[model samples]
Target: MPVNPPQAPTLSGDLLTIHRLLQSPTQIQRRLQTIQDLRFVADKILTARYRSSGGAVLYDVSEPIFNTREVESVAPGAEYPKDVTPEGAAALAAVSKWGQATQLTDERIKRNARPGDELDRVLRKVVNTIIRKVDSITISAVASAVTATSPAVDNWDVSTANILRDIETAEAAIEDLDMGYNPDSILMSSTKYAFMASDDKIATLRRRETTDNPIYGGDIEMLGNLKVIVAPASRLPSNDVWVFDSTQLGGMADEAEVDPGYTVGEMAVQIQSERIARRDAWEVWGRRITVPVIQEPGAAVKITGTNP
Candidate 1:
């Protein structure tokens, strides 16, 4: 005969509050197991989608084709296939499988420097030299323009005006060094970004600084006021500020806040979402070529290559 099931025990408190009364270790364990199973299923679906999109599988074909093909021989010996059971899926998802996380120490260095810090002073000089180099290039390009007179006499004035406007726009961009964030720096590093400055320009500026002047006496006097000109050929604006924004700077803090409820899987998803959003936003609102190019100043005059 089959055994009879146990009858329910009466509770001292309200019967409606059944959750408090049914706190058996076995029941708790079972519920936890069920949750784990569901998580496993969710993980399998996610893993399949991920793998189908770009994941790859490696197999050892040395084993027998049919009955002898075991999971161990085909899949990684230590790392099992994520497509298997929920537990396996969960384990894969829970692990840190991404590249090493890095912090923007250079940005912090840029931001945390006091108004007169030596590093701050150095950065200012570097930026100013870049601006000067860009200005020189723009001037030279304009000076080399071939003069072009309109066939119709009436349009000559308009053409000349447009040429002047182009020059002004190009000059303005060279004057402003504020680009979006130091996106290039984030991809590379501050050292690399600084290296983009021409060696001659950097060397020239380094030799001209005052040894013991008040830290804030020159361009390095203000935190965000330093203007670094990029190469004119690069055509970056003079006012563009290459520094990190709040979101990029906050990444380290976000990673450090992980707790019990937050698994590595959740954090990875958040990071992916953040990167995607940042990339989309950058594509939409980042630096744009706003100025129209004018033929070198002498182009309209029909002068060949030679500046008058």
Candidate 2:
């Protein structure tokens, strides 16, 4: 009788089921998309594809004119011409890594959800970080926007304040542009939003009075024509605020779908060294991309104050 060869050890228990999670690469992508949707800033801006090195181009044309001109000496009104402008921008990507060989330890695999849960949290952190980065770009865009500062609501720490008065002033800034873009978003820091939320005017109201109004109850309140947002303080300073139309000025450019998918193999085989056993390692990696741009400068303006 011939001697039999030895067989390599294999994974068991919940690790067996985990292959189901790793096998489906699209699942990771779906989770990453969910992360993007949860991020306030990411969900609000434009998304475009990334061109290699030279960045990508966008086209812009002057607004259309209304046909309200009377003919003079058989001459038609100023004719609109075929005019288009090409603008270019670039996208940047950030990558994050998680997981380790210990996650695949024999006893650990019995309660495999532990490792899986840890990986999920790590991925969420990565995606959230990317969203914050994108928000910074938006803040920069509004930093130098047309002025609409008002002392009445200028300082958040001020003893006497009025959110409505400040908002009215900000809306005037957008309308003053006459760009036809409406102020649809009210973006602020969490700190600033908290100030508004706890204010006597918003926080204290009769139930019957607020039966038709939701802003009176929530920290993130809304006006008739504007949606209030309490963004992260790290991303947007509490000292400044903005009212703008995302469709007209804000864009997320192009972003690649994240691939938080993983692969299982041996440390020695993958790294080309006597690292460890064949099933000693696992890794979670993914990519996030974005090119946030301000298309219409006049569409968004910084309100509030610039005091020390």
Candidate 3:
């Protein structure tokens, strides 16, 4: 016969009352302040920021394409050079709602004894879950918008891989556009970073006696002209690298919260709580109303097959 574990005793008396709940809305906000300090690479990727007006559901992303410039020496009184105009396109980014919730059951509260500790733990998890969702969404938008992809001459993990040359080629693609976009940032997984850091050429440069500066010290801060950003595999593919100008790449837009008591934060995350009388439980909920808009896809170049 199979044996089942005994159930935890129900929490009653003062514990069962909504008034006795350990986490009030005020307490939730305080906890959120501490959690909000964490930095997300996605935020760094999209340097441009926007706020949606109340009751707004969509954000318009403007894409401008510049044509070749005509500069020439003119006669003394000649009319000014021909006017320059850029073909423009726009994409509608639909704001999506993302939420995560955890229920604090009566049995769980009774088992923990300290309800405050339990609530804090659950609240942190709820917020983190929502943040991950937002990060994934932002990275996905970047990948989709950057339709240009350059396959590595050789896998980055291989001994023959010319990481520096590959990066230069990728950067050249964006610069060749002549649209004034400079590829200033590189996005990749930590695994690919380690591979690049351990490559023979990089190792040789570090050992050179003539130079005091190295490509990487404690962290992979800068590689040549590009600032390195190691993204989580959950957000960026481990086998791919992205080189782009953050200034022109894209941005994030979030819907403003109009609820009487709720105010949006830098991350645009909101936390809420509800009491269940019959079940004698408290529900912790976290949500974000946001969308990532890719404004200039040409500014970014994706280098795939960086890893095995």
Best by lDDT: 3
lDDT of 2 by residue, 169-227 (tens): 77787777666877788777767776666566554542445444445543344664778
lDDT of 3 by residue, 1-308 (tens): 54478656555454544335434566557656666545667777888877765534344343445544767788998997775675556445667788887898766766765655666678678777887888888888898878887778799888889888889999999999887898889998878888887788777755454343334346657888889998778777335899999998877777765465453456667777777889877777778887887878888999977777
Off by over 4 Å in 2: 1-13, 30-37, 45-54, 59-115, 144-154, 203-221, 255-279, 306-308
For residues 12-75, could you state the per-residue lDDT of candidate 1 as single tens digits? 4332222321223333233223322112111111111221111222221112213323455454
lDDT of 3: 0.74
Ranking by lDDT: 3, 2, 1
lDDT of 3 at 116: 55
Native-to-model Cα distance after best TM-score fit, residue 82 in candidate 2, in Å:
12
All models: lDDT? 0.24, 0.50, 0.74
Error of 2 at 137 (Å): 3.2
Question: Any idea what lDDT model 2 has?
Answer: 0.50
Model 1 gets an lDDT of 0.24
* Worst lDDT 10-window in candidate 1: 282-291
Name the candidate, 2 or 3, with the larger lDDT value: 3
Enumerate residue pairs that collide in model 2. 46-252, 48-253, 48-254
